[model samples]
Target: MVLLEMSIVPLGQGESVSQYVARCVEIIERSGLSYELHAMGTIVEGELGQVLDLMRQCIEEVAKSANRVTCTAKIDYRQGVTGGIRSKVASVREKLGRVAGPN
Candidate 1:
């Protein structure tokens, strides 16, 4: 599995871009892939192709509504690991001797 942290922004969409963010989140949700939305970006877990395709979809959708769009993505892939979205965080908290909060 692959873990991808992605942020899609529609440029010149005024100061608040919550609506655009919401639209991207909606696309991610519809993909049926496991995902978590954070303040700066969203993390999604799936195969590399699936995740990349989803990212493309978001960019395409946002471009239709804005003059320009910017997207950033960071991907992590482990040879034999899955569920890094939650497990990666849990691993860190465990080493710190603390239980993870809501995943």
Candidate 2:
């Protein structure tokens, strides 16, 4: 089960947080994938690729309804027990150390 962290930035239309989140939930449901949408402001999480794709589609649909409306998405996958991507990368770096220059 892949976990994803996403941030969606809505433009143009003055959409409330609840409204935007509701729209996102609807889109995810339509995608035929099981997901959980957390209401913690801008950031959201769920299944990896599926949720992100649905979020993009929802944003597009919303934009079509409102002039100049657009949204940007950022997604990151969770590695293991720890949630943060930075923590995961740091763990990897500690194991690998710095690479030597090619001779």
Candidate 3:
């Protein structure tokens, strides 16, 4: 599975962008992909094409409102691997012998 971190910034919208960000997230969720909303961006887990397509959809949705939009994404494509969003962080927490809080 490919792990994607996406942050969409809608330029000229306003100081607060939560509403626009939420719209982009909705597009991703509708794709039925596994994802996590974070403080700065969203983490998505799926196949490479799925993630890329979702990114395109998100950008399109955001563009409907704002003329200038920035879609920043980082993809981790691991063959024969999955659950990177949680597992990657968990691995570090484990190495530190830390117990995570309830999700």
Candidate 4:
């Protein structure tokens, strides 16, 4: 499985680009892939090819409206592993819960 974290920014679309971001989220949602949307980017988990293709679609879709677009991505791949989108976070939280400290 592949876990990809991506952020698509459409240039010259003013200070706020939530509208474009929303479109990208729409595409991700429709892809039926497990994903998590965070403040800085969205993380999607799927086959490597499908995930890359999805990112391409998002970039092209945003380019249709914006003059220029920028995409930042981080990818993790592990053979025979899956569901990292949620499991990864859960693993961290599980470890954090073991810590004897204040929140």
Candidate 5:
């Protein structure tokens, strides 16, 4: 799985936080990948290649607004696990015949 964390700064248009977030949400939804949009960031999780492609598309869509927007996307990725870090660790424990301890 791949997770992308992005911070977008929009310039010249004085775009509200809500507007910026809404635009990002729209782009993410249009990408057809499962995503979570937050007040200051977005999280996208999916297959590596597809997520990367969609991230690029998202950046491009934001760029098209003609508002002198600049976006920085920080991506952290893991392979072969869809349920994220905890699930990955649990799977490893299961394979090793040891149950995961309580958090």
Candidate 6:
């Protein structure tokens, strides 16, 4: 599986971008990909092609109402690797001898 940390910004939108963010997240959820929403962005895990397609869909969807849209994505593609979203965090916490907790 591939992991993507994606942040979509709708330019020209007012100070609060909750609407656009919600819409983008709606797109993510509708795609049926596993994801985690964070303060700065969303993390999605899926196949490479699907994740890229999702990014394209996000840009296009936001562009429908947004004058300009900026998308930032951090992709982690690992062959024969899966489920890094939760496990990766757990690995680090284990190394630090700590338990999982709310962020």
Clashes of each: 0, 0, 0, 0, 0, 0
TM-score winner among the candidates?
A: 1
Ten residues in sequence with the least summed lDDT for candidate 5: 80-89
lDDT of 3 by residue, 35-90 (tens): 99989999899999899888888888889998999988898999998888888888
Return the TM-score for each candidate structure: 0.94, 0.47, 0.93, 0.89, 0.66, 0.93
Full-model lDDT for every candidate:
0.90, 0.55, 0.88, 0.90, 0.71, 0.90
Candidate 5 versus truth, CA RMSD in Å, comes to 5.4
Better of 2 and 5 by lDDT: 5
Candidate 1 vs 3: which has more lDDT: 1
Ranking by lDDT: 1, 4, 6, 3, 5, 2
Worst 10 residues of 4 by lDDT: 94-103
Model 3 — which ten-residue stretch has the worst lDDT?
94-103
Tens-digit lDDT track of model 1 for 1-103: 8999999888888878778888989999999999998999999999999999999999998899998999989999877898788888899989989988964
CA RMSD of each candidate after superposition: 1.3, 9.8, 1.4, 3.0, 5.4, 1.1
lDDT over C-alpha atoms for residue 101 of model 3 = 49
Q: What is the full ranking by TM-score, best candidate first? A: 1, 6, 3, 4, 5, 2
Per-residue lDDT over 1-103 for candidate 6, one digit per residue giving the tens place of the 0 to 100 score: 8999888888888778778789889999999999999899999999999999998998898899988989999999988888898889988998999999754
Candidate 4 global Cα RMSD = 3.0
The model with the greatest lDDT is 1
TM-score of 3: 0.93
Error of 3 at 102 (Å): 4.4
- Which tens-of-lDDT digit does each residue in 12-63 have in candidate 4? 8898988888999999999999888889999999999999999999999999
Off by over 4 Å in 6: none
Give residue 33's lDDT in candidate 2 (0 to 100): 57
Residue pairs that clash (backbone atoms under 3 angstroms), model 2: none
lDDT of 5 by residue, 1-103 (tens): 7787777766776656566667767877887776766666887777778777776776666677755777778777766657563565587889889989853
